[model samples]
Target: MLLEVRDLHVEFHTRDGVAQAVNGVSYGVEAGETLAVLGESGSGKSVTAQAVMGILDMPPGRITGGEVVFRGRDLLRLKEDERRRIRGAEMAMIFQDALSSLNPVLSVGDQLGEMFTVHRGMSRKDARAKAVELMDRVRIPAARERVRQYPHQFSGGMRQRIMIAMALALEPALIIADEPTTALDVTVQAQVMELLAELQREYRMGLILITHDLGVVADVADRIAVMYAGRIVESAPVHDIYKAPAHPYTRGLLDSIPRLDQKGRELYAIKGLPPNLMHIPPGCAFHPRCPLARDVCRTHEPPLYEVSGTRGSACHFWTECLNG
Candidate 1:
C-alpha cells in the first residue's frame, strides 16, 4: 500500500464541545489506484486528509489514535521535521479551493518553483524552468507567459490547473485531491478530472479523491468508501457501489444523484441532516435518516460486515440493503 490510514480518529475542541470528526476510519490506496472518499460536507473526509497530510490544527484539533502508515513507516510516530520532508517530496495534497490555496501576491511560477527549490535544492533559474515544464505538462497553454502571472490573472479552471501542477511538481508517490472540481462548470469539471486521471496514470501514483458529488467520481474512482458522520458505512469497488449499495447511507447518496430520466419528477434528497459530530446517534449515525433503520439500529452499533473479500458495510441489515 502506498498509504494506509488505519483506525484513524480525530477530534476538534470547539466551544460547543469535542467534535468527533473522524472516528476509527480506515482505508488504503495503492500505487496506480484511485480511492474515492465520498460523503457530504463535515463527513470527516477533509479532516482525515488533513490529518494524513500533517496539516491539521493542533490546538483545536487532535488525533487521539491511529496510524497513518506510508510505505511501511508510521507517519504519526515521525518527528515534525521528518513528516515535513515527506509532505511535498513523497506525498502531496491538492486543496478544494485553488484561489485561496495559492498565494495571491506571488507569481504562479515562483509558487510552483518553490517546491523544487525547497525539496530538490535547485537554483531559482532552474526551478523556474521546471515550473514551466510542469505547467505545460498539465496542458496549460502558453505556460512560458502564464508562469509569471498571479493567481488573480487566471480563470478558475486555469488556477486549478496551476494547483495540480504544483502538486505534481515532485511526482509524489501519492496525492490527495479534496474536491478539486468544486465550483467549476460541468465541462470544466470534466476537463480537470481528466487531467488528474491522466497525470495519475502517467506517474502511476496512488490517488485519494475526496468529494461529495457522486457524479464526479463515477468515471474516475477504482473504489468507493462512503462516509457518514465520522465513520465509513460502506466500501467496495466503484461498479459494485453504483450497481448495488449495501448501506442505507450509500443508497441515499446514490438516489440523490440527478437523473435525466427523472427530469420532470421531483429530485430525491436524503431525509434529515447529518448528525452532530459531538453528539452523534447512539448506534448507527445515519439511523435518523435511514428509511430501513430498525430498533437494533438505535442501540447496538453494527460492526463492519464483510459482504465480499473486497467489500464491507457497517449496517446490521446489510443483506436486506443488498437485496434491494
Candidate 2:
C-alpha cells in the first residue's frame, strides 16, 4: 500500500457545535491503483483527503484519532516541517478549483517552476525550463508561449491541466485529486479524466479520486468506497459496486446516475439532504432516507460487515440489499 488511512476521525469545533467530518474512515491505495471515494457533498470525502495531505486547517479543524501511514511512516506523528518536505515531492494533491487554487498574480510558469525551485533546489532559469517541460508533458498546446499566461487566460479544462501538471511535476508516489472535473463541460470532463488516467498509467502513482459522480470513475477506479455522513457505507471492486451495491446508500447513489435508457423518465434521486454533521442521527446516519431502514437501523449502529473477501458494507441488512 502506498498510503493507508486507518480509523481516521476528524471534526470541526464551530460556533454551533462539533461537526464530525470524518468518522473512522479507513481506506488504502496502492501504487498504480485508483480508489474513488464517492458520496454527496459533506460526506467527508474531501475532509479525509485533506487529513491525509496534512493540509486540514487546525483551530477549527482537528484530527481526533487515527493514523495516516505513508511509506512506512505515520504522517500524523510527523512535525509540521517534516510533513512539509513530504507534501509535494513525496505526495501531491490536485484540488477541485484550479483558478482559485493557483496564484492569479503569478504566471503559470512561475507557479509550476516554484515546485522545482523550492523542492529540487533548481535555479530560476533551470526551474523555468522544467516548467515548460511539464506544460508540454500534460499536452497543453504551445507550452513555451503559454507558460507565461496567468490562470484566467486559459480555458477551464486547460487550467485543470495545469493543476494536473503541477501535481505530476515531482512524480510523487501518490496523488489525491478532489473533484478535478467539477467545473468542466461533459466533453472537457472526459478529456481531463482521460488525461489523468493516461498520466497515472505512465507514472504508476496511487490515486485517491474524490468525487460524487459515479459515472466519472467507472472506467478508472479499481475500487469504490461510498461514504455517508462521515462513514463508509459500502466498499467493493468498481464493477461489483455497479452490478449490485451492498448498502442502501451506495444503491441510492448508483440509481441517481442519469441513464440513457431511462431518458424522458424522471431521474432517480436519493430522498432528503445529507444530515448535518453536527447532529448526525443515532445508529445509521442514512436511515432517515433509507427505504429498508428498520428499528435496528435507528437504534444500533452497524459495524462494517464482511460480505466477501474483497467487500464490506456497513448496513445491517446488507444481504437483503445485495439480493435486491
Candidate 3:
C-alpha cells in the first residue's frame, strides 16, 4: 500500500468548544491508483489532506487520534526532521489556490527548483535546468522564458500547471491534490485533469484527489470515498458508487448534477445546508438533510456497514437506498 489511514480523528479547540472535524475516517490507496474524496465544503476533505501532510496547526487543530501509514511507516510517528525529508520527495501536495499557495516574491523557476535543492542537494544552476524541464513536461509553453516569470505573470490555468509540475517534481510515491483545477475554465479543467492522469500513469503513484466537482474526477478516479460531517459515509469503486449508491447523501450528490439526457426534467438538488462543524448534529451527521433518514439516524450513529462485497454505507436503510 502507498498510504493507509485508520480511524482518523481531528478536532479543533476554539474558544467556543471543540469542533469535531474529522471522525474515524479510514481509507487506503495503492501505487498507480487514484482515490477521489468527494464532498461539499466543510466535509473535512481538505482537513484530511492537511493531516496527511502533517501541516495541521497545533493550538487550534489537533490530531486527537489515528494513524497515517505510508509505505509501512506511520507518518504521525516520524520525527519532524524525518517527515520534512520525506515531504517533497516521497509525498507532495497541490493546494487549492495556486495563486496564494505560491510565493509571490520568487520567480517561478526558483520556486520549482527549491524542491530539488532542498531534497536532492542540487546546485542552483542544475536545479534551474531541472525546473525548465519540469515546466515542459507539464506542457507549459515557452518553458525557458516562462521559467523566469513570477507566479503573478501566469494565468489561473498556467499557475495551476506550475503547481502540478512542482508536485510531480520528485516523482513522490503519493500526491494529494486539493481541487487542483479550481477557478479555471471548463476547457482548462479538462486539460489539467488529463495531465494529472497521464503523470500518475508515468509515475505509478497513489493519488488523493480532493474535490467537490465529481465531473472532473469521473474519468480518473478508480475508487470514490463520500465524506460527510468529517466521516466517510460510503465508499466503493467509482463505477459502483455512481451506478448503485448505498447512502442517501451519495445519491443526493449524484442527483444534483444536471444531465443532458434529462432535458425537460427539473434539475435535482439536495435540500438544506451542510451541518456546521463547530456545532454538528448528533448521530449520523448527515441525518438532518438525508431524505431517507430514520428515527435511528437522528440519535444513533450508524457504523459503515458492508452493503456488498468491498462496498460500505452508513445509512440505516442500505437495501432501501439501492431501490431509490
Give the candidate number with the greatest lDDT. Answer: 2
lDDT of all predictions = 0.93, 0.94, 0.92
lDDT of 1: 0.93
Q: Model 1, range 195-226, lDDT digits (tens) per residue? A: 99999999999999999988877989999999
Clashing residue pairs in candidate 2 are none
TM-score of each: 0.98, 0.98, 0.97
* Residue 36, model 2, lDDT: 98
lDDT of 2 at 144: 97
Rank list by lDDT: 2, 1, 3
The root-mean-square deviation over C-alpha atoms between each candidate and the true structure, in angstroms, is 1.0, 1.0, 1.2
Off by over 4 Å in 2: none
lDDT of 2 by residue, 1-324 (tens): 889999999999999999999999999999999999998889999999999999999979999999999999999999999999999999999988999999999999999999999999999999999999999998999999999999999999999999999999999999999999988999999899999999999999999999988788797899999999999989899999999999998888777777867565676788888999999999999999999999999999999999999999999999999999
Higher-lDDT candidate of 1 and 3:
1
Worst 10 residues of 3 by lDDT: 259-268
In model 1, what are the clashing residue pairs, if there are any? none
Tell me the number of clashing residue pairs for each predicted model: 0, 0, 0
